[model samples]
Target: MRATTIHAPFDMRVEEVPEPVVQFPTDAVVRVLRSCICGSDLWAYRGEAARQPGQRIGHEFLGVVEETGSDVTTVQRGDLVVAPFMWSDGVCDYCRDGLTTSCEHGGFWGTVGSDGGQGEAVRVPFADGTLVQLPREAASDDRLLSALLTLSDVLGTGHHAALGAGVRPGATVAVVGDGAVGLCAVLAAKRLGAERIIALGRHQVRTDIARRFGATDVVAARGDEAVAAVRELTRGQGAHAVVEAVGTEQSMRTAIGVTRDGGAVGFVGVPHGSGTGVDLGVMFDRNIALRGGVAPVRSYIPELLPDVLDGTIDPSPVFDMTVDLNGVPDGYKAMDERVALKVLVTNG
Candidate 1:
């Protein structure tokens, strides 16, 4: 099978790799039908996140179950399923509490001996806990496939941001960042009943999608200007809640600054650069709450799957470009150059 491997920064290639097989009783071998590059995947591609030479990369994917281990009963052969970015055992205490990302036995794909999602197939551990089964008929629908694919990561992470920020009916919520995750956060806020969704993004392409996703206001400003814009929209007060989707110091500061005192900020960006650290004094003085991490996507998949299948929320617009497995390097470049919001890779 051919898979994506990162030899170094800006160097991605497709190489022939051995196919995966069920290695654990709780594992299942999925024939990847669709996969995509994630914004976070850029961290390693840019050398921000250390990467081993020839390391397998990618994590968002949905597929058909080709085989299941003896202990895997929840999914069977031919069932179309989606695997969360992280794999977790369903019975762990953290998983039971809806924090599966912190499960005792949870692990990410493309690490050590695990298979990455950007390939023909992958061996998914904790299959019963990590894989969400979709209607068998969904395989033939392009719209549903795109939406289901987002459930594996970006969409769920966006939903996590909204949930963490404590978005409520009639509340004014500001989303910081205009990436795919940021746009999805806007959608999640709308679904949660936020009356006003303020999106802070400079790119017109993404801001346009944010509007379609339910952003009531698009503030193309940054720093002080961005904060002021949000404040102006909120009638001199900041938003009641803020979702910080870009994990940068400036973005985090913007999120904190634009949030009303006593409000919360849900930060989901993978912290990078000077924005990696935060000033506790600032948060303390404002009485602001911060919550978010690697989203417990598995926990949210069940809740969001129905909406995706029923066409209640269409997130496919985030995928602005499509490519075959071999065109992944160009996909990365498109995103890096800001030419594409997200890239969808189909197994062809």
Candidate 2:
């Protein structure tokens, strides 16, 4: 089998590797059908995430189950499944409370948990707890692919951001960054009944896509001016909810500054550097509440899957490029350079 491996910063290659096998009673092996590059993957690709040489790169994917261990009951061979970025033991206390990301037995897929999905096949730990069974026929629905693939990460994270931000009917929400997560935040906010969704972006194409995803207003501003633009759009009152999707100090500040006093701020960007350290003083004075972390993607998948299957949301538009496994190096490069919103890689 061939997989994408990172030897060092800015160094990525495709090489032959041993195939994975079920190692635990709850584990299952999946034959990769589709996978995509995530924003967080860039940190490892850039050598900032403490990954070793030849580490596998990728976390989000949809695939068919090839085999399952004795204890795996929710899924079986031939099932098309999507899983959270993290694998969790469903019996953990946190998993019971819908905070599976914090499950005591939970671990991340690419960073600290299971083998990543950016190859021919992967071994999924806690298969019954982590994987969501999608309608077997959805693989070919382009409109639903966007939303279904999101059940694995971005769309769920975006929805988590909106929930943390307390978006409600008739409320106005502001989203910082125009990436897939941010655009999906706009979509989530709208789906949650927000009357106005303001998306901040610099690229015309991204802004256009944001609109299609439910952004009622687009601000092409940068720096503090972007904050001012969001504020001005709200007649100096600022939006009721603000979601920070860019894992940077600047975007975090933009999210905080453009929100109204007592507003809610949800942050989902994997903190890149010292990007989002909070200012206690401002938060205290403004009476704002901050919430959000890695999304409990597994917890949300059950409710979100029906929406994807029923055509209520089409999240797959985020995947701007698709390539065979051989083109994964270019996929990473394209995502890192902002030439593509998301890159989908197919093993079969």
Candidate 3:
């Protein structure tokens, strides 16, 4: 089997690696059909996020179950499933409360002994809890593949951001950044019934998708200008809710600044610079609420899967470029250079 490994910044390679096999009774061996590069993956590729040398990378994937452990009765062998970026046991207290990302027995992919998603196959622990089965019809529909893939991470993360920001029907919402997550946030806001969505982005290609995703306005400005643009769109009052999808100090400040006094900001971007430290006095004076973290993707997958299957929303456009397993490095380069909104790596 071949898998992607990051040796250092700007160095991603697909080399022959050991195939995954179930070591625990709760595990399931899945043959990955599709995987992709995430925006957060760039943090390590750019040297901003700490990553171990030769660490296996990638987390977004959907596949067919090749084998199942004895304990995995909920999902059987040959089931088509989407594995959330993080694995979790479904019975924990946190999982019961819909916060599976904080589950007591949960873990992320690519950790020391775990298999990453960017490979021919993965041994998914807690398979019954972590893998969501899809209708068998999904396997032959190429158009649905990308949308189904987004449910593993990006779409769910965007939904988390919108939910964190308290976006509601008839409310005005602003999304910071135009990355895949940001564009999906626009879709999430719309699905939640937001009356108006303002997207802050400069790229024409992404902004176009943002509009297709339901962004009512696109602010191509930056810094203070961007803030003013969002405010102007909101009739000088700022948005009722803001989704900060880019993890940067400047984007955070913009999200906070463009939100009304009593509004909330849901930040889902993988923070990249100096942490997400904000001035206490500023937040105190404005009474603004801040919420969001690694999204509980498992919790949201069930909620969003139906929509994807029913064609209520199509997020497949996010994957502007597609590559084979061996083309993983070029996929990373396209994303890092902003030449592609998102890249999908297919093994079929």
Candidate 4:
């Protein structure tokens, strides 16, 4: 089988790799039908995130079960399913509290000794607890399959950010960043019944998707200018709730700046570089609440699945480019260069 591997910064290659096979009672083997590139993947592509030579990449996938371990009961061979980016045991104390990302036994894919999602197949651990069952017929339903794929990561992450920020009916919301996750945050805020959504981004293509996803205002600026734009849009009071989808010091500051005095900020961006961009005194003075971390998408799947299946929300537009297993290297380039909002990798 062939999978994507990173050799160095700006170097991604699809090469033949050993195929995956179940090795534990909790394991399942899945033949991947769809997987996509994540913005976080760019960290490794740029060498910002270290990797061993030939390390596998990607964390989102929807597939069909080819085989399951003896202990796996929730799904079996021939079931169509979606695997969350992180595999968890489902019955842990933290998992029980809806914080599966902190599950003691869980781990992320594409890490050392784990199979990558951007491949022909994957060896899924904790199979019954990690893979969510989808209708077998979904294999032939491209539209639904694409939308369902987002449940593995971006959509769920956005939902987590919205929930963290305490999004509620009739509230004013602002989202920092126009990445796929940011656009989905607008969608999630709408799903949570926000009356107004302000999206901060400079790219028209992505902001257009933000609007389609539910953004009522677009601020195509950055830094203080963006903070001013959002404040102006919110009648100089700032948003009642804000989702910080871009993981950067400035974006974090912008999120905090544009949040109302008593509002909350839900941050989901993968933090890198120095400082968290937080000031304790500033937060104390405003009584602002800050929450959110690596989204526990495995826990969010069930809550968001029903809406995706029913078409109440659609996040597929985030995938503006599609590539096959062979075109993955180029896919990264497209995203890193800002030519595509997101890339979808497919295998028929």
Which candidate's TM-score is highest?
4
| Per-residue C-alpha lDDT of model 2 across residues 205-273, encoded as one tens digit per residue | 888888998999999997689988988899998989999998787888888888899998899987776
Q: After superposition, how far is residue 168 of candidate 3 from its true place, in Å?
A: 0.4
1-348: candidate 1 lDDT, tens digit per residue: 999999999999999998889998999999999999999999988998888888888899999999999999999999999999999999999999989999999998888678898989999999999999999999999878988999999999999999999999998999999999999999999999999999999999899999999999999999899999998888888998899999988988889989998999999998878544466887898888999988999999989989988888999999999999999999999999889889999997
Q: After superposition, how far is residue 176 of candidate 3 from its true place, in Å?
A: 0.4
Instruction: Write candidate 4's Cα lDDT for 1-348 as tens digits.
Output: 988988999989999999898899999999999999999999999999999999999999999999988899999999999999999999999989989999999999999999989999999999988999998887888888889999999999999999989999999999998999999899999999999999999999999999999999999998899989988888898998999999999999999999999999999998876988887778899988999999999988888999998899999999999999999999999999999989999996
* Candidate 3 local lDDT, 1-348, one digit each (tens): 889988899999888888888889999999999999999888878988777887888899999999998899889888999999999999999999999999999998887677888889999999989999999889888879889999999999999999999999999999998999999999999999999999999999999999999999999987789988888877788988899999888889899989998999999988876756465677899998999988999999988999999999999999999999999999999999999999999996
Clashes of 2: 4
**Using alpha carbons, what is the TM-score of model 4?**
0.99
The 10-residue segment with the lowest total lDDT in model 3: 272-281
Which pairs clash in the backbone of model 3? none
Sorting all predicted structures by lDDT, with the top scorer first, yields 4, 1, 3, 2
Model 3 stretches astray by more than 4 angstroms: 275-277
RMSD values for the candidates in order, in angstroms, are 1.0, 1.5, 1.1, 0.8
Candidate ordering by TM-score (highest first): 4, 1, 3, 2
